[model samples]
Target chain A: MIDFERLRILTESAKYDVSCSSSGSSRRNTKRGLGNAEMGGICHSFTEDGRCISLLKILLTNKCSYDCQYCVNRRSNDVERAEATPEEICELVMSFYRRNMIEGLFLSSAVDQSPDATMEKLLDTVIRLRKLHRFNGYIHLKGIPSADKKLIMRAGEFVDRMSFNIELPSERSLKLLAPQKSKVGILSPMGYMATEKKQALSLKYNKFLPAGQTTQMIVGASPESDGQIIRLTQGLYKKFALKRVYFSSYVPTNEKNALLPTSPVGILREHRLYQVDWLLRFYGFKAEEILDENENLPEGYDPKCHWALKHPEFFPVEINTAPAEVLLRVPGIGFKGAYKIVNARRYGKLDFLDLAKMRIVLKRAINFITCNGKFFGTENQLAVKNTLLLTSTDSVILSQLSMFSNDEIRQSVLQGEI
Target chain B: MITFIFDGTKIGLFTCVFDAYYERRIPKTITDKQVQVGFYDNVYQIETDTQKAKRVSDCLKNCKTIGVLKDVSLALKSGRDDKFTVIFNYVKTVIDNKNLDVSKNFANESVLAFSDLIKQITYEVHRFKGFIRFEESVDGYYYAHFSPDNDITWLLMPHFASRFSNQAFIIHDVKRNVLGMYDGYNSAQVNAEDRQVTVYLSDDEINFKKLWQTYYKSVNIKERKNHRLMKNFLPVRYWEHLPEKQVEIASF
Candidate 1:
C-alpha cells in the first residue's frame, strides 16, 4: 500500500488542474482486464468544493525544476517533496479500482529532474499498467511540453486522454510570469498530436488518444479578456481538434509575488466564461458573435441572453414555426427543450400551457417566444431586461435560502431552471 | 368507478392491462396497494397470468419503433404510488392511436407523465452508478450498500458486471431488501428480506479507506468552497454510505 502522507502530498499538488472528465472514450475491458471507460463518464464522488472526483487524480512526484510564479510546486518553493515508483502506482490504482473508490487514474507529474525523464516515468507507468497489470481502465496523462515528441506520442498510445496546460494565455504573459515556458513549446506538441491523431483516424486506427487532447488556461492570472481567451479557444478547437478547453480562475498560492496578483480572481468570472464556452460549442454561436475581440462577457446575463438582448430584431420568434437552431437561441429553452418542442409540435400546435408542462422555463422564454400568436411578455426591452435580471438573481438568493431544506427541494433547487 | 389491485410485479401490472381490455371496463385506478373502497365503487383482484401478460407485452413490443415496452418497464420500476395508473393510461393512448405516432406527442398528459417517470428512474440509475462504493471483504469479495429512491438495484447489474468481469461483488439495496450479486462469470439478483451476515474487512481496507479520506480532503481547494454545488451533485442522502464523508474518531 502507498503511504498515506505521500498520497496526500501528491494529490494536493495535482488538485489545481481542472480537467477531471473521463468522457468520450468507450474502451471495453479485455479478456481478463479489470475495467472499461464509459462514453458519458462517471463521477465517483464530489468534493467539498463541488468538483467531481471522476478519477484518482494524483501525481507520480511533486519535485519540480521549473519556477512558474503562479505555481505552488515551483523549484524555488520550500514545500516537502516526494516521489512514487511505477510499481507502487500500479498497485494503488488496482486496489482502489477493485473497491470502486475511483473510476480510473489521472497520472500527472511536475517536471522532476528533467522533462525527458519525467515523460519516461509516465510512459513506464502506463505501459506497466496496461501490459503487466492487465488494467484496461481510463488513464489521462499530462503531457510534458519540452519532452521529446516521440516519447510523448508513445505515451499517448496507452492512455485515454492527455492535456498540456497553457497556464498563461499570451506569449507576453508567459515571459513575464513563467519565463522558462514558451508558447511554441506548448502549441507545437498540440499541433503535432493533432496531425498524428488525424493520420491515425484516416488509417482507421483507434489507439492514439481515443479521447483526444485538452488544454487549460488560467483566467485571471495575466491580462487577457474573455473575448481574447475565447478566440484562442476557438482557434485551438479548429486547429488541433481539441476535445475541451478548460479555464481555471487564478487562485493565489504564493505570498507577495510582484508578478502575480495577491487577491484571487472570483469564480463568477470563471462561471461566465464556461457559459460562453457552452454557447460556442453547442448553441450554434461564433466567438465574434458572442462578444468583440476585447470586451469581457457581461456579468449580469448569460451569453445566450446577452446575444438575444443585443439583437432586438431577432426577438419574438414563433414557438410553433421556428427552426431548431432558432429555438436554441431563446433564453430559457435548452437543447432538450428544443428537441421536445420540435417533436411535440409535429403532432399539434404547442401553447404556453404545453410549454409549462414540458418544464420549459417560461419566465425568461416568454419574452422571446410567441405561442399560437399570443404574446404575454412585456414589449419594452428595458422592462424585459429587468425581469430577467431579477429572476436570475432571485434564483441565486433562492438557492442560498433553500440550502438547509429537505432533500427533494434541494434537488429541484440544484437542478436550477430548466 | 372500478379499482384494480395487482401483486406489485411487472407481470401483475401487465395482467391488469390485459383484464381491463378484455373486460371492456376502464379502471378508475390501478394499484398494487390496498385502498379504501367506497360503497358505489367496484373492486377487482388481478391474478397474474403468463399468457395474458405475454399478449399485452407483445402488443407493446409491436410498437417497438417507439420503445413503448421499455418506457413501460422503467416507469413501473419507480417507487411512486401513481406509477401504475401513469403507465396504464399511456399504454392505452399508444394502443388507442395505433396508426399515428402518439408517443412523441408530449401535449398528451398521459404521455408526458410517463416520460417524466422514465426520466426520473433513468436519472437515478445514472446517479447510482457513480454513487455506489464497494468495500473489500475479508475473503476478497467486494460489497456495497445503498438505499436508492427507485427499485434500481437490479438495473445496475449489467453495468458493473461488464466493468468488473473478473471480480466477485454484491450490491445490497437496504431499502428494497434486494441484493445484486456478480460472481466473476455471471450476475444474479435475490431477495434478502430477512437475510443477515457479518462482514469483516480485510486488514488493508482500513488503511486504504484512511488514505482515500485523506486524499479527498487534500484535493479540495479551500479558496473555492461551494457547498451548495457540492450538495447539489452529491446530495445529503448519499453521504451516509460514503466513507470520505464519515468523520473519523481517534481510537486508542
Candidate 2:
C-alpha cells in the first residue's frame, strides 16, 4: 500500500489540475480484467471544493527541474517531495478500484529529473497497469511537453486520455509567469497527438487515446482578456480537435512574487469563462461573435444572454416555427429543453403552459419567444434587459436563502419551482 | 369511478392495460397498493396473465418511434405512489395512437408525468453508480450499502458486474431490503427483507481507507471552499457511506 503521507503530498500537488473527467472512453473490460471505462464517465466522489473526483488523481513524483512560477512544485519551492514507483501506483489503483473508491487513475508527474525520464516513468506505469496488472480502467496521463515524441506516442497507446497544460493563455504570459515552458512546447505535442489519433483511427487502430486530448489554461494569471482566451480556445479546438479546454482560476500560491498577483482571481470569472466555453463548444458560437479581442466577459450577464440582448433583431422568435438552432439561441432554453420543444412541437403547438411543463426557464426566454404569436414579455429592450438582470440576481439570492432551508425547499429549488 | 389494482409488477401493469382495452372500461385510477373503496366506487383486481401482458408489451414495442416499453419499465421502478397510473395512461396513449409518436407529446399530462418519473429514476440510477462505495471484506469479497430513492439495485448490477468482472461483490440496498450479488461470472438479485450481514474489514482496508481520506482532504483547496456546490453534487444524504466524509480523526 502507498504511504498516507506520500499519497497526500502527491495528491495535493496534483489537485490544482482542474480536468478530472473520466468521460469520452468506452473501453470494455477484457476477460478477467479489473475494470472498464463508461462512455459517460462515472464520478466516484465530489471533493469539498465541489469538483468531481472521477479518477484517483495523483502524481508519480513531485520533484521538478523546471521553475514555473505558477506551479507549487517548482524547483525553487521547498515543499515536501515524494515519489512512488510504478508498482506502488498500480497497487493503489487496483485496491481503490476494487473497493469502488475511484473510477480510474489520473497519472501526472512533475519534471522529476528530465522531461524524458518523467515521461518514461509515466509510460512505464501505465503500460504495467495495462499489461502486467491487466487493468482495463480509464487512465488519463498528463503528457510531458518536452518529452520525446516516441515516448509520448507510446504512452498514448496505453491511456484513455492525455493532456499537456498550456498554463498561460498568451506566449507573453508564458514567458512572464512560466518561463521554462514555451507556447510551442505545450501546443506542439497536442497537435502531434491529434494527428496521431486521426491516423490511428483511419488505420482502424482504435487503442490510441480513446478519450482524445484536453488542455488547461490558468485564467487571470497574466493579462489576457476573456476574448483572447476564448480565441485561443477556439483555435485549439478547431486546429487540434481537442476534447476540452479547462480554465483554472489563478489561486495565489506563492508569496510576494512581483510577477504574480497576491490576491486570487475571483471564482465568478472562472464560472463565466466556463459558460463562454460551453457556448463555443455546444451552442455553435464563435469567439469573435461572443466578445472582442480586448473585452472581458460582462459580470452581470451570461455570455448567451448578453449576446441575445445585444441582437434585438433575433427576438420574438415563434416558439412553434423557429428552427432548432434558433430555439437553442433563446436565453432560457438549454440544449435538452430545446430538443424537448422541437420534439414536443411536432405533435401540437406549444404554449407558455407547455413550455413551463417542459421546465423551460420562461422568465428569460419569454422576452425572446412568442407562443403562437401571443407576446407576454416586454417589447422594450431596456426593460427586457433589466428584467433579465433582476430575475437573475433574484434567483441567486433565492437559491442562497434556500440553502439554509429544509430538503423540501432544496428539492423545489432543484425542480426550478422557485 | 373505478380503481384497477395490480400486483406491482411490469407484467401486472401491462395486464391492467390489457384489461382496460379488452374490457372497454377505462379505470379512473390504477394502483398496486390497498386504498379506501367508497360505496359507489368500482374496484377490479388485475390478474396478471402472460399472454395478455405480452400482447400489450408487443404492441408498445411495435411503436418504433419511441421506446415506450423501456420508458414504462423505468417509470415502473420509480418510488412515486402515482407511477402505476402515470405509466398506464402513457402506455394506453401509445397503444391508442400507435402511428403518432405520443411519447413526444409532452403536452399530455400522462406522458409528461411518465417522462418525469423515468427521468427521476434514470438520474437516481446514474447518481448511485457513483455514490455506491464498496468496502473490502475479510472474506475476500466486496460489499456496498446504500439506500437509493428508487428500486435501482438491479439496474446497477450490469455496470458493477462488467467493471469488476473478476471480483465477487454484493450491493445491499438497505432501504429496499434487496441484495444485488455478483459471483465473478454472473449477477443476480434477491429479496432479503431485514437481512443483516456483518462485514469484517481486511487488514489492508484500514490503511487504504486512511490513505483515501487523507487524499480527499489534501485535494480540497481552502481558497475555493464552496460547501453549497459540493452539497449540490454529493448531497448530505449520501455522506453516510462515504469514508472520505467520515470524521474519524478530526484534523485540527
- Which candidate leads in TM-score? 1
Interface RMSD of each: 1.0, 1.0
Q: How high is the DockQ of candidate 1?
A: 0.72
* Residue pair clashes in candidate 1: none
Clashing pairs in 2: none
Per-candidate Cα lDDT values, in order, are 0.87, 0.88
Backbone clashes counted, model 1: 0
Candidate 2: residue B52 Cα off by (Å): 4.9
Chain B TM-score (each prediction, in order):
0.89, 0.87
DockQ, all models: 0.72, 0.73
Off by over 4 Å in 1: A390-418, B22-24, B38-42, B49-51, B248-252
